[model samples]
Target: MQDGSDWYGAATATFGDRVAGAREALGMTQPELAERLGVRIKTVRGWENDTAEPRANKLQMLSGILGVSLTWLLNGEGDGLDQPAGEAGARLPEIRTLLSELRDIRADVDNAAERLARMENRLIEALTEGRVE
Candidate 1:
């Protein structure tokens, strides 16, 4: 957060941007966030991907839990988080490197989830065909 920027500002950031940035700023993993929200990890992943949205109740909870205003999360209008202040210049490269690694890890997680779903579907089909005990 030492980059001296509104990493999740309203300018052109989407809801996903706010959610993911806030989560990372807080050092919360996706599974941790899901547990706190009483939802599946997939739900959190979808939010991060901008592929789905939470219901109103979940939305309220999300804002509260994430320590960000609802308006900011929705349309980036109200209060949003600031990066943690510190010596940034020296760590800028490291932060960028870690962020890149995090993205790659997230992609792998998403891929694994999709593969798991496919495997589950295959098992279900096998059961339906009376091929599995």
Candidate 2:
């Protein structure tokens, strides 16, 4: 599995198979990849076991970290690992930083949406109770 040819076959590989193959090709342990992605090791295990899939943002980060295209990561059919390991490592810091910012922005948006929902509920209750008249 170290060479990424382990997945070559007539049948289409599952998402987990691609993930495991790519990680193995990169010589990355599950723990190492999880730490780089800022996720728990169990999360990586879940992905590799086909028990879970990463969120879109995490998938993007995983692609970058694994030096494979997102399409390849998902379906195993695309430009996979065109870059050497050193080149991939060179781009990792930038990609990680951008991903972190995106995550923070997403969190803020979620919090704002929650607050708006609460406010809307309060307004609806007040109106229905004749308190807003």
Candidate 3:
């Protein structure tokens, strides 16, 4: 935001440029994104040109839908937003280990849910057949 550029304007330009770059990298056209966002092609072009700003909800949706990070859009920092360093390196092996554990826990929860559903069906069948004992 230095060099006499308006801070807000600079921010908008950064966001818009990154948005367009990310979209192009993903091989999406303005019309394609407009369809995904339920916006007009003009609206998408306005965002790319910094002519207009998106609402807060749209911004969040854009981040998710574009597969980038809000921080990357606003500040142009990190590895293309939502991708911080040390996420997959030995420097943060503990964090990676913890992430693996979390995934395992999630899998366990899914397995438990499936087992519970099967158990419920068995219980219902037993009750319907008067085999409660």
Q: Against the true structure, what is every candidate's RMSD?
A: 4.3, 13.4, 15.5
lDDT of each: 0.77, 0.70, 0.64
lDDT of 3 by residue, 8-121 (tens): 123323566677767876899989998998898777866776557898888888878877667666667533522223533333446545644654565566567779999999
Q: In lDDT terms, how accurate is model 1?
A: 0.77
Q: Which ranges in model 3 have alpha carbons more than 4 Å from their true place?
A: 1-13, 79-133
Could you say which candidate leads in TM-score? Answer: 1
Q: Give the range of the ten consecutive residues with the poorest summed lDDT in model 1.
A: 1-10
TM-score of each: 0.67, 0.54, 0.50
TM-score of 1: 0.67
For candidate 3, the per-residue lDDT at 81 reads 29
Off by over 4 Å in 2: 1-10, 81-133
126 Cα displacement, candidate 2 (Å)? 45
lDDT of 2 by residue, 82-131 (tens): 33356544775575466446545655665677799999999998889996
